[model samples]
Target chain A: MRNSFLTVVIFAVLVSATYFYLKSPEIVQTKLEVLKENYSKPRDKKPVDHSKFEVLQKQFNSPQEVVKTCMSCHNEVHKELLDSPHFRWQRPVYENGRGVTYLGKANAINNFCIGVQGSEVSCNKCHASFGEEEAMLAIDANAENIDCLVCHDNSATYLKGNNMNGFPDKSVDLAVVAKSVGTPTRDNCGVCHFFGGGGNNVKHGDLEKAQFHTTNEIDVHMADNGGNLICIDCHTTENHNIKGRLFTVESSNTNRVSCTDCHTELPHESTVLNEHTVKVACQTCHIPTYAKVNSVNTNWDWSKAGKLDANGKPFETEDSLGDHVYKSIKGTFEYARNKKPDYIWFNGTAEHYLLGDKISEKETLLVLNKMNGNYNDEFSQIIPVNIHYAKQPFDPGTRMLIQPKLAALAKGEGAYWQDFDWLKAAEKGMEASGLPFSGKVDWFNTVSYWPINHMVSPKENSLQCVDCHNSENSRLAGLNDFYMPARDKYELVDTLGNLMILLTIAGLFAHGSLRYYFAKKQK
Target chain B: MKEVLIYKGYERFWHWTQAVLIIFLAVTGFEVHGGYSFFGYENAVVYHRYAAIGLVVLIFFTAFWHFITGEWKQYKPTPQFVKEQIEYYLLGIFKNAPHPTKKTVLSKLNPLQKLAYFGLMVVIIPLLVITGIIYLFYRMPSATNMNPLNLTNLEPIAILHTIGAYLLVMFVIVHLYLITTGHTILSNLKAMITGYEEIEEDDDHHKKEEKKV
Candidate 1:
């Protein structure tokens, strides 16, 4: 009875401890929430005369506010900032705007710079550090505009001065700027462009190391073509406005000059052209468009359209276009919407449509050159002319340049035109004969194009080899005109007949070896 | 004296063949698992796969022979020396002690040995074989279906195979050490070679011998 009581007492203590342990997490969470709610909604209570705290806050605010106050005198710098791509961003909002977010907008920058862009709150902190001294700015007034020396000053060494603080008032703290200015390093850029957050997406491939601020000795992209180009080179301020040029191409809607504008040459060497010549234009292939492709996020509903039922019946039909139609259908009348490539099959129109007038090969080259001038960086296309000419005599207006056979043939080709050379043979043959190759080449003709296939099907170039030759025919054909050439042919017959002699010898040797082994075993 | 060969020539042949093959597999298996590179990784994988297949075939044949010869009775574990044998390995081995039980033609293994061998044959080997075969024919991921072979973490099967190999290696190290602790230092090794062992006659065994005479 005593032992049982002791066990019960121990069990009671364990149960109490366990109950408290499980409840602690919830209790702590509730207390933390309560504190947060109280702090967020500050109420008017008994005012304490906190003079010392106010003095400390004033000192910090005075020096930091210098950048904003100086902006009044240096109005040019402020104007240039308006033209920057950063202007697209609205003031840093907590979670609403499309700017950088601290909670991390899905693919955008992190939460820290949610409101600010170029001259926004966070950027101004580090950027305006060079314009600290009034005497320095008086000597070179333009230095206050960009102040590239703040970060990129390579000859700089550590020194002592005011650490700027505050947003609007102009005052300087005396104690903190006491250290020497360290050598300009990539770490300076890392202050903004680390891990691609905070609205500063400086792409240099190797994100672990900051490549923008410092004179990165090693070219991250092209080791050989490494030039001493700074951010201002690509991002130049025009009209006292920190603005970059934007291309008028229908594709790129944003404001910024493309790197390809100056560096007309591709970073890597082109396979088709030598170093001296320019071959394929970059814009012709990787053509940019202002509108994004495939804008719809979800699948479509087709049940709402009022149309005919399967068997000559009228009903409601909802096509993928999101439009309702009431119709009657007896035959399989196909429909297409949105001009998507796959939807073309149901359009009931011919395969492909042409756009422009047909031009000769020489004219095509001239037109290409005209559309894409030597220095101009843009893409041009003459789709209608080229497409119509390719499918000749098919009522060029009504006939689409749909190469049904060509599309089927091109299916398994590697990314580049794999079987283009083979297809060129047929094109060349027709061109050489100067005759019209009327219809498309069928599957059989495509496969049986080889010379070996021609012998098999003499009528259609399939693979038949024994059509003209046999052993009896060979003998007759060899003796030309039946004249005195029979001795060589008859004597040469032993060459093909030697296999019988060899087999007889092999059989005898096998028989003798077996007999000897069996006889020895018996002994 | 009735002359008794505890192990037959074929039995020893199968024993050594399996041991050598298992050791080869373990070495190559570790190399394939990127533990270290003695042979190149690809070659080691090929060699390990071939050795594993041969070991499986050898095990199949060995099991068949054991059943046919009624030698499967040798692995039947009992309470005989169950505690003493555990004590022998745990503490008595260092003191130059005699074995708790003797090996005879009828019963060559102690209870501990029987249980370990039975566990290895029934549990570990089957697990390794089944997992290995499934891993070898694993399919690529598809749009319609998830990965066909669903191992817990998608860790490469070679890692699991390497774990099995390490377990086998530990077993081998203990086995080799045990083989040396016989009537004489090299007596067990020699017995395996000559199919005979000079077992020391204890008081009970000697009395039984005299009674038989």
Candidate 2:
């Protein structure tokens, strides 16, 4: 019987060993085949030289003149641009399968500079449309108003000043800009996006000027030494319609660009890891921390605006990280760097609080964006986001949030920045937006969430298992809908388990000592 | 005085190997649970998984050996001597009274040991093995295929595995102390090491007489 048992054991061990050993060769062969397929793909050819174009040789006077010349050749481009969210500044919102309202920068109030209703001149600095007057121009009639050089200019000289009617500063050489027109580079996009909310590295935490020529440590995909990819690589655009969505006031029907477009769902080598793709977003793991290069504004208290130094001049203060913590024209700000993101289950859909949305007096309103999803939703994935908090103005009597005409002071209007007068600015803003506002003014807390989608770290720097799994102060600590091992515990089960262990140990000692006493007595 | 060979070489090897694997698994497993961080969380998880695999392999080999050697009968439980064994441990041992049952090469386990070992081997060990395997491959099949188990919810399996771990810990503590209950303090420990045990001549004579009757 013993010999038979030994034989069976040896046979089982040999079979298992043989099976694994045989399986290794096939796995290695498949891996090599996959690697070959990945590397053998054709490389991209160089872009067409704009210098060869005959029409670009002529000298242009104004930025508008440069656009007219480009339109003469690229006729259909203007029509496509006119239909885009960049040109319209507003997109139709559909709720419950019915078009409800057009939400965008034009009318939607944000926690930042409020809205563009009474401040089109200053706010239109980032607007894709040409001229401050173009904001009032009919969307279909402004086909000629699309500023082509804003995105297409390869010349580093093109510069747009605040309230310059979307044209470059007077000193900019339009002739040089027209001649150097090409596909948008990171520099062109970052000119406006990186300096959004009044200064550099202020709005979006992940975007900054440093990203244009950054190392792999800053942004793996956009790194000059690494991927060296341009904005068009991921934000693939066709017919002037950019394939991306910003979590702003705008309601866009356009599809948001996702990492999965290039990297498939099962991008990871481990099958176990690939399974996490179901509930965990690719960005959640890839971009472990946002604002890697610079500190980003996390909070803005508008009530603290209008502070003056001893010289009676508007004072500005810096935070510990050298980011602007207080700008008298703006507010008291809080900045954070290498900021851990707040996680949420997002279903790729967001709802915005429009200009006139009635807010509750008890709870702080999510004024900018709210991710729409729950744990039960199969479409949802755990995504990292940045929540920017603000204390902004609202009409207490009207029971509605008000948009303060923040930039109206630049135009010598009765704006909040001019006289530190909330009522006058709120009235002017409401009038420009065509909404009624009560004379009474009050302050309310608000929050805006921006999804962290950039500054992807290398896989080696990705979050470890215990980072989110084992601690009460974990990233997903507030997410109570699902049970996570180590992070959560059942009280009854833990109590019983500990009790059983204690009892067993006590019983063992008791039995041993009793046996020892009896043996000693017998001896 | 008489000496009897009880444990075979393979049996002793299997027992010691299994003991080492279980101890390693428990220590690393507790660290993985954030009970105490000794190996660090990442290393603890890796070591725990490897030890669990080692234990599973040992269990397979030991089970095969037991069945083929007919040593599986050692754990076959009987209620006949169970009450007396309980009484002997509780009262008779303190009074220096005789044991409830005689130990033979074929029937080496006491009634209490047979019951406890039966439960541990058949229920608790299998429970831990199944749950651990489920957790190790929880994220299998990738995202391409619809996972049949839908292990998106891992709480239930984790709870079961932890419970099994607790039971195993309790059993080890009791087994460790029970080793000191032999004729001399180190008798059982020495017997396990050398595969031979000393039996009283008077007990051996009484067992022969009773067998003849």
Candidate 3:
């Protein structure tokens, strides 16, 4: 009977194994082949030939002339560009169905340069619309103001002047640039966005010029040897409205671009990992460390600015990473390389303190941009972010952070950079912003958070279980919202469990021995 | 005393293979849990998975062999002499008292041995195998996206698997000590190796019948 049962069981197992071994692979292979076939085909659209456009043949002396020529063919280009936040430098925010305030680089208060109110000339170097006259142009004006070459130019010669009020340098050949205009490449967009906070790899720790051609290990998606995806691939745009946000003031508008738009909510094969996506952002694991190529400015002490050597010449010192740790003109800086991001619960929306907002005097640390979410919020995800700290000027009386006219030093105005005079610079900046400034100027520590959106490591390089589940020195140790298994333990439950296990073993041993002893005594 | 065939060749092969696989699985599994890093995390996980699969295959084969050879009956629990067998190990053996149950080729395991082996095979081993297999393929593509089993966390499964492992470890420790309770220290060990054990000439009927066979 047992032999027959064994034979039947073995036969059943063999049959099932054979079925799966032969059938499952064929099914999976067919599906994989279909997917591969779909992906391998190139995009249907043909590349535009810029050489054929006769309007770009003429020599242009000014950036305005180049814009005028571009508008000749693409007549409605200015209308589209005018509506874009890149051109306007402001986005309208609605509060309770009413337009409250405009937020962007035009009005946003940041730890890095504070505000663009007084530093329009230096800050607007990255502004899309060209010429100083364009800054004053009416919102609905039909004029040659938009700089087409800033994004579309392929000549690589279009260099924007530092103080030229959004105009390119005269040394650039405008005709060559105008003729070579094509689709925006990584280099074109990176020229301004990559070098955001004064210099290359200064502001956002994740973004840098090196991302244009990085190794797969550094960024699996953007790297040339990896996915080789363009910015537009994920940030799919519609009618010139790019689907992304800078680390500026909060806007009422929702972002169209997200990782889930391409990858889906449950991208991971593991069910446990897929579940983590609900409360953990994709970048938290994918981007293990930021600033892979260069060290990022972690802190800036504006109070230490305007320091000079014995010869009266401005001095600068380099950090261990060859980055400027201190410069007499700007401030003392702290740089960090391959930094692990500070994780926080973030929803899509954020709240930012605008310029001239009255802050608490007792509050030493002021948040420039506050992510709107908490542990209880269903929409919140644990996102990795880079926090840039700074000590900047503030009004002692009103306790409001004062934006200093640091850029006005170049124009010989009442700037902090001119004579290291904080009160004069603060007064001028407050006047430009049309806000009342107290005579007494003080410094306050502030933090500005920039969400890490780049430098994605390969899947294999992602953090393991114990990375966050450890009791000590864990990345998620600071996060007390959720109970992590290995990292958290209930004292009573642990003690009881240990006691039970100990008692069970002891009881079993004692029972066996005592029964034997009694039986031996009776014998 | 006379030599009699006890463990068969296939039985011995199954025993040794299962022993080695279990030990390998335990070492690698514990390392993967961050207990201690020997082969590093990645390598430990890989080896643990392989050993688990190997054990699963061995289990099926051994189960089939045991049923086919009519050796499954050896592990059938008999209440008779169970107390005596327990007393022999705990106190009787120490006092030089005689064993209550005699060892035979057909019924080699004592009543206490039957109970322990039954618990291990029916409860603990199955628990370990089921949980281990679940963990191994939990990340497989087919198991993901609309997870039917709702295996959203590894914590619960991991805890269960660890408990099963501890039980098996305890069983192994007791088993190692029990082998020393034979007539001679090396007697049981020699029986498992050479497939023969010495038994007292109790029945003349079996002695003449064995020689004739």
Candidate 4:
């Protein structure tokens, strides 16, 4: 009887085991299907709008020589702007802007020139107008100053009647004008500053690197809607005005203006930094303004080349050996003869050009030698620079300096240009400085040394939240989010996860209870 | 009259070892599933995994012991009264009914006990083991040809592992409650603890025959 009972129990167990094994797959499948179905339901979410600036298609020309006119009354402000890059145009010089000169005027225009003629209407918008064009008069009527209040009014909007040039009128409300332009935007600075252009155009710097702003698009200082680095983001009109460098000269007059005045603390907080008081000064590390030319400041000294003065005397500058493209010493030159013995130079900005190309050592030295070592590494050096030339097809009157060989001319020893490969030299330099050299070339040459500015470089560009709090500041940073509102929605994976866990727990409990009852009854 | 050695020392050893391991696995496993932390979640997980691995290894040894000793015959179930055992569990369990099958030294567990124990060993344990392994090494993939460890989310695997945990919890609850239903309210419990049980002999003739032997 005991043996038979054992036999019966073993037989029943085998059958039950087989049945459970077969049923498990179906149970697991059903549970998984239910979870998958539940997960498909949509959750409310939105994508993030990260762009801060908008591109305005309209262009406007001012009727009066407003900048010049204002300059007569405000000499200090006039000098500051004149020294700044805004007044200069890197385009070719024109006679009457109509190809009219004493030599029967063929349009082989000069690439660099000083300010525009007073009588021309095309030049008036960006230039100073003398008087009414219909009745040309005194030069005083055309001002040399840039009035801060005109385009900077925050409370105004461009009315149809006020904007005759079909240029978008920068009319703001008087209330906003009473206050400050809502912290600055990329557009506020981009109105005059630009990067990358056609042949003979000046590419001021490399703004196309991904590490800097994650894109190739040039970011005007005021463009960040979320309130990125503005003009005052780093350079303060107060502390920066009285500060050491000209770029950071903070005058009591512009006291409240520092890039830090509005941007405040550093946008990037270090994981190590615990205290706020120990924060660094903006220009303490950023030192000088960026430029493409190896000249004293952004102002190129054309007088260096010997030119016949009005009295027709040979006037040679300290550095110039009378080797340049321009015939007159006072006029700007497109190319310069190499003065250094150990290096080679290339005037290939016109020929093989991309914003960021690697310069070959053999090819570069060959070009440097041809220019007699007077090679400006800012332009001729092996590093890549996307040149943004005069694009409007019209001259803005001021000479825009473009130097290509300044980076390689440092240390004044061992002909560093020849001894070192331009690529290695730059890479090492950037690595040591902890600066990115993807395609951004914004180093300025003052006297013999090149100083890098953090303000102009994308390193200084911000990713701040408050960069676009006020509408007047970030024209696009705020607008882009609205244009494409970001929705942070929950994904289907989460729903499925919840369902699987719930059903699995419930089913297991029920099955176990049933098993317990069966086991208990046989006891 | 009948003298049969139903279980040897090693046989009882393996049975009790397996039972302890299962119980430990269930308790710690639930704790790891964020169910009221006892010994903390991290400690509970460590204990659960250790017990599970021990249990799996014990199963191999137990299966070998069973085969060598022919103890696998104990789980053999008969169809006669199989339906009655099922009905007893389904309906009569609540009515305080008498048990349909009896336990002898040579033939210990009834048809229902055989069936439940067999399902657990063959199906549930293996399922738990597979799901547990997937959970532990879900982060580390050894595929040489695949893209460098692209797994960013762990929620799905976590859910599956948690399901296995819940199953173990249910089994433990029912198993614990069933121990109280034996004769004298503790006979089976005493038998497992001491390896001896007092069997009820209802036939006086059979008793006289056993005494004469």
**Which candidate leads the pack in TM-score?**
2
lDDT per residue for candidate 3 within B103-155, as digits (tens), equals 77866787799999999999999999998877765531122243345444555
Judging by lDDT, tell me the better candidate of 1 and 2: 2
Q: Any runs in candidate 4 off by more than 4 Å, and if so which?
A: A1-523, B1-8, B90-97, B137-139, B142-161, B201-213
In model 3, what lDDT does residue B109 have? 81
Mind giving the per-residue lDDT tens digits that candidate 2 earns over A107-143?
5667777778777767888887677667755456666
The share of true interface contacts that also appear in candidate 3 amounts to 0.00
Q: What DockQ class does candidate 2 belong to?
A: acceptable
The digit string of per-residue lDDT tens for model 4 on A1-523 reads 4643454465446545644553343211223234335434432132421122121112224413323333444456544433332222222222222242221001111222212221122222332112223112222222333334333423344221221221223552323232332333333333333321111112233221211232212232322322244344344444113222211111111223334433333322331111111222232222222221221111233333234657755343333633233333232333222111111222221211111223342431111101111122222221111111221111012111122111222333221122322234333433432334443332221111111222232444322212222233421231221110011112343355456656756755675576567668767
* Model 3 interface DockQ: 0.07
Q: How accurately is candidate 2 docked according to DockQ?
A: 0.34
Candidate 1's docking class is incorrect
RMSD of each candidate?
30.4, 4.2, 7.2, 25.4
Worst 10 residues of 3 chain B by lDDT: B139-148
Q: Write the per-residue lDDT of candidate 1 for residues A292-364, one digit (tens) a residue.
A: 1111111111112124347634454445644332222111112222111110000000110111222332321
**Better model by lDDT: candidate 2 vs candidate 3:** 2
- Per-residue alpha-carbon lDDT of model 3 for A334-452, expressed as tens digits? 98888999988776666677877788756879988877666556567788989899998888897888988877526358776665677888888898888998799878899988889
> Against the true structure, what is each candidate's TM-score?
0.29, 0.87, 0.74, 0.30
Q: Residue A386 CA error for candidate 4 (Å)?
A: 31
Task: Output the worst ten-in-a-row residue range by lDDT, candidate 3 chain A.
Answer: A22-31
Q: What lDDT score goes with residue A186 in model 2?
A: 87
